[model samples]
Target: MQPGIHPAYRPVVFRDKVGGLAFLTRSTATSDRTVEWEDGNTYPVIDVEISSASHPFYTGQSRVLDTAGRVEQFRRRYGDRH
Candidate 1:
């Protein structure tokens, strides 16, 4: 716990544009852009490409890769040794 050597931690907004979601939380990250939150206050906003809101895993929209097909293709290309 050192004084004057740590970045300031304050309330900030994380915005997921693709998912159209925004949330307020404490972070050390900074941004020139700002947005008015539900509380009627402006906070530094950070735009993120992906977040839990829109992430495939979180949204349950992830595709299950066809591993069986890939394995068959590999074996066909290079005959299975075993």
Candidate 2:
């Protein structure tokens, strides 16, 4: 509990460009750009590449790697000689 030693806590808007999701939260992060929120108030806008909306795990669409096919391909290419 120090005086004026901690970063200023304020509301910031995080905008997910890919998912088109915007959220307002309190944090020390700031941005030069500002955007008018749905609450009729302006907050610092911070753009992010990935968010929960577009994330595979969060969206419940897990990415599946082609492990079996890749292994077979690798065996055909290298394992046969060995």
Candidate 3:
């Protein structure tokens, strides 16, 4: 490892607003915003649009695509070759 070349790694907070979830972890990412954590310490907060808490795949809320409908639509648009 080189000195004075690597970004500082420190504890930071990742917030998922949609899921109302926040977690503290080490990261090189920085932010001007800050928040008080459960441990009574302040850390930089990063707002994220999606995380495992709210993600469809992780939450098992994924939407099932209507393949049959799509196939029928395609056939209607262009007569079936068969």
TM-score of each: 0.87, 0.75, 0.80
Q: Write candidate 3's Cα lDDT for 17-58 as tens digits.
A: 899999999999999999999999999999999999999999
- Clash pairs (backbone) in predicted model 3: none
Q: Could you give candidate 2's per-residue lDDT for residues 11-71 as a string of tens digits? A: 9999999989999999999799999999999999999999998898999999899999999
Best model per TM-score: 1
Query: Ten residues in a row with the worst lDDT in model 3?
Result: 73-82
For model 2 the local lDDT of residue 44 reads 96
Least accurate 10 contiguous residues by lDDT in model 2: 73-82
User: For every model in order, what is the number of clashing pairs?
Assistant: 0, 0, 0
Better of 1 and 3 by TM-score: 1
User: What lDDT tens digits, residue by residue, belong to model 1 across residues 1-82?
Assistant: 8999999999999999899989999999999999999999999999999999899999999999999999999999998897
- Select the stronger candidate by lDDT from 1 and 3: 3
Best by lDDT: 3
Which whole-number lDDT from 0 to 100 does residue 69 have in model 1? 98
TM-score of predicted structure 2: 0.75
CA lDDT, every model vs. true structure: 0.96, 0.93, 0.97
Predicted structure 2: clash tally: 0
Candidate 3 global Cα RMSD: 2.2
Better of 2 and 3 by TM-score: 3
CA lDDT, candidate 1, residue 45: 100
